[model samples]
Target: MKACLNRTIAAAGLAALLVSGTLPPASAADPGWHTSSSLIGTSKYGDDFKRYDYVNPNAPKGGTLNTTTAGTFDSFNPYIVQGNPAAGFAGFGGGLLYDTLMEQSVDEGSVSHPLVAEAYKYPDDFSSATYRLDPRAKWHDGKPITVEDVIWSFTVLKANSPLYNKYYANVTEAVATGEREVTFRFDQKGNRELPKIMGDLVVLPKHWWEGTDANGKKRDIGRPTQEPPLGSAAYKISSFKAGTEIVWERVPDYWGAQLPVKIGRENFDKRRFTYFLDDNAAWQAFGKGGFQDFRAESSAKRWATEYNFPAIQAGDVTKSEYPTTSGQPMQAYVMNTRRPLFADPRVRKAITMAFDFETMNRTLFYGSYTRTDSYFEGGELASSGIPQGKELEILEPFRDKLPPELFTQEFKLPVYDTPQAGRENLRAAVQMFKEAGWVNRGGRLANEKTGEQFRIEFLGSDPTDERVATPYIDSLRRLGIDATLRIIDESQYINRTRSFDFDMLALSSFAQSQSPGNEQRDFFSSKAADTPGSRNLAGINNPVVDALVDRVIFATDRDDLIAATHALDRVLLWNYYMVPQWHLGKVRAAYWNKFGIPEKQPGYIGVDIDSWWIDKDKEAALAAKYKGVN
Candidate 1:
């Protein structure tokens, strides 16, 4: 089936998008609607006008850009660390020193041209793949990028980084074929997912990193530095002032400076990232002009009201309008299928049917979100319009495994928003309880045998979560079910979810990679359920889902692969593994207006870093306009 999907896409018109420098013809617009150009050696993004080399001949570069995420960074080693602001910064910061062979476009709609490699070739069967590197690819220190570097990366990542284990577990062997070539062979056949996986794997250098192991064996190259390390990229870490600041200077002789993938993206020669433990302090810095620009999360009220502050009203600040679908990553209440209460598919379905997403959106999110019905949303991959005849055939055996009402529009679960839908869903909840042997006595549901009341705790973080969750708690109480909301700090929240120690909790799965592989197993396979910090929020372990995940990873072509993924999604939906939640219609973002962003808009599907560029003219104009300003 994946072959068909791939064939259809290949036949549709993406060939033009893949080719560099050819103006996208008007006749080629339909089927490649979601496809973006992947122009080689430059940032033009194929020949699409939307992203044609948008160079401002007069635009000067040199300014500071400030952004904020959820937390502070005490650790400087983002490569080996799992979760933290430093890791987030490492994604775009000075860490690109060990430049990767390739990178995904900011939006992830298209692939970036090779940075270190000239091209990568995959076997038609996908069991083996090879990379031909650009001999010119060199580290900042003038050492050439070679096959040994790629192998060194594999050895170090597999040995030390817990996060690296997620992407590297499938590899059976990685071998250096030549000075600038490397090949990887997988343990399993029919798995064409390695190429996509390699796109996200950051490479390390062999000359600097290949060292003796703890046991002193020459082949035992240890894990790469948990702190700042080196290789070749646009920026190199200069110094990190303990708890306050991290500074990186541009590599004046960056080997890939002219590489298409690095061209417009890393224009800034130097980047300085500051840290503030408190969000309010960060906001104050932006207002006081301590930073070049601000990229931080904000409340809608603050977005609409606070921007009118004197600093903003005077045009010292500006906001960019960026929108993304809600649950762009699916985060909501998930039931652990490995646990007995939810092991029964009927119970999972019942829980989903009882969720009121519309109310949650309206009340908690200020109607700024959309409910998600599938793991894939707003794309052809979503099952919303797929021909379900075949899927229904696959679902036949599990017919009795799920309740009858699930196939209908009435019982379809939506993303939570408000309290009304919660109340409305209680009727279905009561029915599910009765069927599950939870007999209601005088309006209180009690276990059929033990007479103990059915009570469960909803574990999560965020103080505002209670605004929407409290209403659901009320509804559960009304149905003779005891539900309570427990809010904790972020660390505790992470520990709880990582240990599989909670009854119910909220989580969102965000895949920067559109080509799904490891993430599928990470989320649904029994193997990953107990793996600390993996994303299997529901802790699901059905053989059917496991089979579907394997099929997806194995399929070489497009249609069969998508069919497998769709099948897996359908099964998960049928089982009600997650009470899917809202998706942001757009990326709700806040940024400072003083900086001049470049004209090369990432072809409409923009990413945070793609749209940023220093505007010297804007800064000059602002300086002329607000001389002696705060």
Candidate 2:
């Protein structure tokens, strides 16, 4: 067989070369488990390293699981932005096919287990994490998974993937201490800092990727995606039909199958991800038993009214709200301040006043979503005060800093159901427009100085957005302003917004972290705005806001972090970088009524797939219950 540098090498060679009597006997220098400093001698656990309650510590495993997603992947190279879910699915599949240094838990919190390494050594606060690679570890084809592989993989991934933001940002260097030992140093001043960021990155093999570039010079692994590519995630590309489907077969006798994340999470015997262009089509196919797991992301009304299976009615399949105490940050309509027309605060406020959110909630969402007032939603690290409580105590100090109207409970933007309030807001909007030198002529607002029509484009992603945005645009048209709806593909939508090219785009900013520290920078920092591909669409550059974000990120105590976040929130609210929209409380997903989903899975959704299981008996019963074809 031809030796492929990028793919996993034979494990026999690895075991023979590194672990087969050639290396020195194991000594005290071998990597050993070290507890997180945050927990120290105490048994208390941080949110980062919470234990799962669902899976028995020693649960039996013998089931074939299938999951359906959207997209096709071209390469096993998980480094580049391929603009497809199949790429992610393929990468995950490859993770099982190959092993990185560490692995994340099902909950994606803390305690990375050893894959190639026997143990991980890090300070309590996670300032640095060092790995003593196991001499016995090998790639599927038998090449040793070594220090060179680790360094090469990190350098390549950090340079290519934009999503690799927090992965190795703190790392100062990765140095090989011995033949089977490597130490990762951090730029931060804290213990356990490295572990928090040490989840598996699917390290690539140096032997495969260490080559020359197009100029015939040695390929720079550190030059972010500049070279062809290299990675060590689970599944490698067997074949790819772009825009159609991607196939990735398992690497024969792959390494790292015993890793913690894999032992529990990525245990699918055979994994393949198929893509469909239309979401409804995909859902229907899943309904007909074309796929094992299907995600429903359409209208809630459709889920309640339209989607009906015999198993769901007979109580054979579980159909209940996935329990969630705290709502995740969600979809919102944000106005880009880069546009000259939206630069004026009054004009932006006027545009926001035109939206009839209550009407849309009643008609479209059926009052399922909460009207969001700030970036963070309830129960988040950033959420402070729904007019009272611990959040209120934090908000009290910022009351003087915030606008006076924002202090009152009723000081929120007018609800669309109240026509009188809506009209009142329109009247105020008219005044603001007049102040900005705009004249109302035949119900059309025109700039008095330039005689330019005050028009704005509301950009959205696909037909779903068009449905919700059209009504808002209609409201604006009625208010003597012309707001056109510009619908685009998901890829184009992301590309345009990332480059800060839109006038007013409908967006749903989901917060990935419990703390609002990083999200704030991505959404509001001038540096992020200036940098391409960052999420700061509004180009907001307030020094006060930047300082608050810095303080919030570094603050140890929860209370101090909340205070700093609230201060930042007030500034964001005042700036109106985005006109807040609704928070769709928990993830509104409907799976095929075949499997038995646990009520108390985990606090977070989307990433906790291991908590979801195949109830073989229930699935068999359901198949019998709904015997006939659709």
Candidate 3:
């Protein structure tokens, strides 16, 4: 039924039937549905396959699972420009309360299974992609999901949301060609990731937004709203106390319940989220078994020191660590290059070298953290040693724009792993600062011409972030840099960060992909530099970075992909745009013992409880034994 079905069929095995004149008319040639994305080669399971291997297909689904968060959510509209959506708002324990066209498989990399759409078709050149919606797909209110909904979703998202607009920049248009078929045309061709990204579109119901409210006012999809939105997913916002707590209940007549992809997932009958204003308060509430079922420990100090509560001792709370093999988090002291002070590469490098990671790890972190050196740390894609092979070839053209030392020398952060650590590093940092036209004057580093004292403010939201930043601030002060730390409220931080209003902030990019596609644009593209809310926090607008980002996105094969990514990683590292922070390979988590998890867990840590179900026996026994605890 898709616009590209005939072309896709001709490229497949069905071409022989048409060529031999054994097939009926072109209208009679029914196209087969796909189980995964086109570039993923083959689905691990055939068309007749059962549920995924990592889930418990027969697991019973009925129990209230509770979760805790530090910050209160102001609105339910996460898709818009304003407000943070509550966690677990979407059914099946993911994001927002809607279904994407296709869902990616957690067990396998780069694979996606149909969710709203039963099948999709696209040409080999990837000029366009078409999705055929499942006839069974329907919204929470029982309206059938149509091609109109898909088109409307694309239109509104691109217009209102900054993230969505930048993400879908290359996508030309989305058109509903048939009752069941919706096609997305791309501006650029031969990029295989286009089709998969099109599948990732968040389909919003058209009638709901255009409809009149109880007060006879039309709802604005562009603004944040407290009114709960309708979704086609497995769960709905059953009840809420606004910023305090949100509870989701399972939809009895969920359309996707019987689908192969839905089996063994979203096992909870009632999922709830309770929010606290502070991290410590949330931690204490979780420790005392006060309206929380699961807690992921963020502070290493707390994980090692403070998990000695009565619940933990009584085995009511189960603590565990899952080693992560996913893309490394690039948490960094991001230097704003738009500011004149950090525009110089030498000054940036000097600032990075001045930080004392070794001493901090010894005293503060209790030796649990690892000093991160690469943007793509702890992965094969990470750039190590010197670039060679195809990676070297990829960098050849951009050699003039890149750092000259990238070809001749290897990139290494100044090691403060020995004695005279503070003095030695500070000396080198002072020398670099002097080279950048700043000198120590009146016990402060001042600009040579302007006489402006070198000062930087570490902007943050959490009060506890000061502990992590204070040690670094002390080190910077030794270099005669007038360093200061300021903690603002959550809303202020979010608004300020979006507008690029800060001297420095510890930021993290949560983007991870086995294929590393177009999202790279939002992260490092020159176009995204001026745009607010982009992940390009350092305001990187170099042509060299832009070129490398394109190379990473349009890579032809696995070899070419790795080569380009490595090259990009090297250039980013040598540039010293970020003062490399620390990373942990695993997530430290603690949850109640009243649930049954899957026999096999996915490589990803968050999926450890994806197939978890309430064990009635354990629940009943715990209730009898520990009465009045929760």
How many clashes in each structure? 35, 32, 0
- lDDT for each candidate structure: 0.55, 0.53, 0.74
TM-score of 3: 0.91
Put down candidate 1 lDDT per residue, 98-131, tens digits, no spaces.
6666655543343444666666666545566677
The number of residue pairs in model 2 that clash at the backbone is 32
Q: Identify the leading candidate in terms of TM-score.
A: 3
> What shift in Å separates residue 524 of candidate 2 from its native position after superposition?
3.2
For model 3, residues 265-301, the per-residue Cα lDDT tens digits are 8888988888777676777777766467776666778
lDDT of 1 at 86: 47
Candidate 1 accuracy as TM-score: 0.79
Candidate 2 lDDT by residue in tens digits, 551-591:
55554444555565665665566656676767554444556
lDDT of 1 at 257: 66
Prediction 3 global C-alpha lDDT = 0.74
